[model samples]
Target: MFFILLSLFIARVTAEAAAGGEESALLRLSDVPAAQAFIDSSEVTVIGFFETDESRGYKEFLAAVKQIESLSVAVCSEEEVWTKYNITSDTISIFRKADVHQKHLQLSETKKVDSDGLVRFFTINDIHYITEYNQASAVGLFQSEVKTHLLLMSNRDMSDFNQLKERLRALAPKYTGKMLFVLVNGNARVLEYFKLRSRDLPRIAIYDADSDRKWLMPKGEISAERVQNFCDSYLSGDLQKQNEAETSEDKTEL
Candidate 1:
């Protein structure tokens, strides 16, 4: 028992050291009074809880977070915070943005997550991650407690995709926490696996995870009004329900 305690203590010390508790980029529970005070005072602040397993992903995570929000990383060593947040894993990341409740980016502490993965994790506002790593993210969407999954599938062009993103951002506030929105690539393997397609540049699709049903937007039309109507119809059960094992082809409207 003494040896076990010693090992734990050593691990904790090592984790803290590796996380650079001294660096201003990372904060500690000991810094909570100040951190919380800052969060309370500031209009926007994002704090990241990083597992202290000498995980090399912190550097990449921190860099990516810097692009959108200034995030301060901390070792997941705070027993009080961990228990309160129900964070039982060593690799989970939590973010509290702009006075809202906390949000989580669940990833593997054991595996290294790339910058693109980190980007996707952060892009998902209050929804599931839209990732292409073996369709795991799509599978995660299917398993999510939320019944709605709004996925944006687009080709290589950024113009149409950007427009759709803007529309999604506008709709996010209206939906609040009722639905999940994710932006996916045009050539995502998950789409192929599900036989979903986007032939005419960009498209929007909805998945009612509860019923295991889906709805695809007709190609070539992506206006805010149309997207809004689609969402409204789904909520009102007015959208066409696609088969569980259906595959649609890419037909050009020439």
Candidate 2:
């Protein structure tokens, strides 16, 4: 009887060990403490979080997180976890330690990491401009004088909007492998000059081979220029630094 009991006990222990090994291979953000402990005991640690459909501005965030090789992720709702962490907005927060509170602080100023780290959102409204083109007129003269006068008379309404959009489209691919999201804050009456309705705005806009998802404001309030400035700042890499810290703890683990 004693010999039979010993054999059964050994079998159970082996099975438990194998299960534990599999569990250790995958890590989640909510399991931060265990993950940190693992990092302390192991050579490296990686964790991943999924952006949900409920998050208003996080459509592009999911793709950005997937680019990190160390992270293992899945599709799931972030509402409960985000509320627990007091994160009201759609964003990704990465850290080297287990303390969630400290990690939140570090994420506030995180920088874009190559093409994977670029995230953007916008709000545009109230763009009204008028212009006319004459096919019989000289192409160069018509462009220079006639177009210039119409734009000037419109009080900067149509000044450089198209040029800026083209420039952003050209640079989009260099920052993010995918196109960034463009949100219209409200007031699309300005687009009436082109006979475009708020809802009829391009669902997908392309520039220089890059394509971005576009959304229009249902109510229209902010100006298009303000929206452009906001986008420029988000893509400028001024707000945050990539993970470049070399702490003694990190070095010792290596």
Candidate 3:
């Protein structure tokens, strides 16, 4: 009789603990103060609200979020999060250090910068790292050099593909050794860009050598010049240093 009573008590305790765990796991956007406090204190916070079971896109987005360091992510209904943030649209919010929030806000209004320009930015969409099979056989050697890693497909058109390639090539020299480039997918705007632009080029893949991860660039008509300008304005300092180092090495060989 005593053992039966003890068993029931243990079961009750276990059930309560499980219930508490579930509650803690939930990120209640209604608790705005707590959410804001977490964002202010953490070095980086990533907030995403989307329907889980119905959103194939969100699943991939979550995978990318996992790759970032010191990033806090919460998945919930769009309506809930929008209500909490007092905004409309299902979007991702990234918060950096509290000290820089005001400055970042100011900069954000002036111009849209590159990834290196800010402490963090939304990827815009999921990345699709392509394999060799998706590449063009005619440019096999160049593909091999790039490792034929990831490809962006915004639409069925070929112009977008060319634009993406040109942009990546221009940007590659800038981030040669420092930061890795990320390609986003599933954006309607990006797809529309590709549909209206070039449509004959083969699909290409973007790779991250450090992590060995691949991301496909979204199909779009992004100008190579624009990409280059963006990189030059934001990443010129780092690229210049890398170029200098290479020049020094050549001189040593001489």
Candidate 4:
């Protein structure tokens, strides 16, 4: 059932791509099932629910989607699909699986709709399973419902930088929707904030944004097993218990 609906969307996109002479063609979904399939097909999917292809924000959405090639983009004029998703009026929405979030921008409520504004909306919500930390991406990362982040801190110039990144990427799917995997590469300010130096180059840490607390892994080989254990310990409350125990010992000495 799912594949049939998904193929309809793919077939439509393929036809449009051939006609438009561009691979970045926008998908046109005709039914609720097709819309759902498109949303579920990618980590991030943008759907513009409009009355018609000529709807107010439709053109802007089409232009903006061409610039952002990282995810899927579709247009749905089906009233049934809009009702299913609770989309009222002309709206541009993003469905992301990383945190199971839906972000909406209602064109009627906004002063203006342009390609640039639409592009910014997509960029600010472009959260993925494993996202690279940066100024533009930090907004999405910090605002994610999953507040805990597994950070792979390293200098990009290091020999094993890409190796560690791929290792972390391979492990990111395990914690998807529960925690966000972030790669902090060669950022001096971030290193200083974590009290780590370039010599400390490659390290793993679990940072909880809600509590603004961080647990840095002990100095050793950055094996996936060790990193996974560290995350599990934090999730199991063992790390909190260990911190409290150390605090009690400090009080006794004082």
Candidate 5:
């Protein structure tokens, strides 16, 4: 089983790096106590085991992890780490948020794994894992000059938003550099300050830096078709948008 899992991970490593980067986010470790502390402090961890850094999975998993936040990756090239973890061979182990619950994934030894799969694995139990935005970073997100954004405002459970991810991920590469898709928690002070209503539990909205306009997707619909069509319409200049008005009711239902 371990050998199969290792082989599967090695296969994923051979695939091309995704759009973002080749940088690795591995945190170097020297002791078991420190590793335990790291596990306790972090919500998730991905540790790659190898006798040396030369393993292909070591380089590949490290690079794949950089695209994700909150996931700590470390290369256990040292024999002490191997003995401590009881790993006799190469593998990528995913440690859940808790201190002890963890299991290695076979991750489809036959299928190719991409950045999407790695991110999905981090949030596998609930696929709608969205980034929470607060007052501090709100400006950078909503007003960035470099790219427009498709932002969803929601704090609902993963089940509510998970399905839309596939469509969003597909649209991402098609519109690369032009738009970034983000999810902001409903509890953000900035969102609360906007006086957004509870009826807006899950809202699809876009921020256009070019026109300084905010476009809201039609209400109560969050399907992939809605997302793709909305983006296509907006980018093609067919969708009408409005500014963030003073009144609670905006031009769009959302």
Candidate 6:
């Protein structure tokens, strides 16, 4: 009897959720403070600033938000709130805390605002503080204004995987505009490209996409202080000088 009651409760909750989903999935914001709070509530959030539910591109924005279930999307029809975010007219904007980037899609300028285009826009700009490296995200990561990347390479199966990621995530904010923190997990192709082996389970490397240069951190325990120092040394030009010295030595030996 107890098990039957539990099943019924689950069914009822599911039914209610399904009913609620028929309405707008967007979290509605009525004022400036509420809009700011929603934007600050997540690492990434999309807010469609529309004058009304019938505004151009509003429906397509909702459909795109639904298609990308991972995204947090909201709606604001208040013109006063729009001024706070610099939304002059119907716009779909994405706010990313990672690099403090605010990307806007001005409906007036778009040739055609459709669900597919919105989805593509979101995917291309879905960069986070610690973005996991993958084909879909590669486009955004490479195109990011921050060309230097601090790569944390590891496999998910590693015992200390989550801890390692947390260490990087915590360090990411300090280097916000200077570097992008990327997590490369179990991508053997990437490992091979970097001349790394599985035995090198957890490692750190700095890759400058602009220069197409990579520097591997000397093998050691991965700690926050050590990683921070590594970044500092690179930014200070110490790493480049050291690399040049080493390269010169290699040529002399040859």
How do the predictions measure up, each by TM-score? 0.52, 0.22, 0.29, 0.89, 0.41, 0.85
Per-residue lDDT tens digits for candidate 1, residues 1-254, read: 45444544453454456534333434344333433443443323344555553555766666666565534334445655566666665544544331134556556543657776765665543232232322445554444456577767776467666666767766755554456676777665647744765654466788766766667777656887887787777777656533222333223322
Off by over 4 Å in 5: 1-145, 188-195, 241-254
Q: List runs of model 2 lying over 4 Å from the truth.
A: 1-51, 54-57, 72-80, 98-115, 118-254
Q: Where in model 3 is the C-alpha error above 4 Å?
A: 1-30, 51-53, 78-81, 98-254
Q: Choose the strongest candidate by TM-score.
A: 4
Model 2 clashing residue pairs (backbone): 123-185, 124-185, 126-187, 127-190, 128-190, 186-220, 186-221, 187-220, 187-221
The TM-score of predicted model 2 comes to 0.22
Give candidate 4's error at residue 219 in angstroms: 1.9
Q: Per-residue error at 33 for model 6, in Å?
A: 2.0
How many angstroms is residue 199 displaced in model 5 relative to the true structure, after the best TM-score fit?
2.9
Residue 72 CA error for candidate 1 (Å)?
5.7
User: Tens digit of lDDT per residue, candidate 5, span 76-129?
Assistant: 555776677776666666664321345464433415555555555554421111
Candidate 4 vs 6: which has more TM-score: 4
lDDT of 6: 0.84
- Quantify all predictions' global Cα lDDT against the true fold: 0.55, 0.31, 0.40, 0.84, 0.56, 0.84
RMSD of 5: 15.4
Please give the RMSD of candidate 6 to the true structure. Answer: 7.7
What does candidate 2's lDDT look like per residue over 1-254, in tens digits?
45444543443343354433332223333332333333333212222333544443234444444444433322223356555545554444432221111222123344432323332110011111211212221231222211211111111244444554444334333323122322222234434533455444332221111212222222332344443443343345321122123345587889
Residue clash pairs of candidate 5 = none
In model 1, which residue pairs have backbone atoms overlapping below 3 Å?
Answer: none
lDDT tens digits, residues 187-235, model 3? 4443343443334333333443334443323334455554444345333
Model 6: per-residue Cα lDDT over 58-87, one tens digit each:
778878888899997777788888888788
How many collisions per candidate?
0, 9, 16, 0, 0, 0
Q: What lDDT score goes with residue 43 in model 1?
A: 25
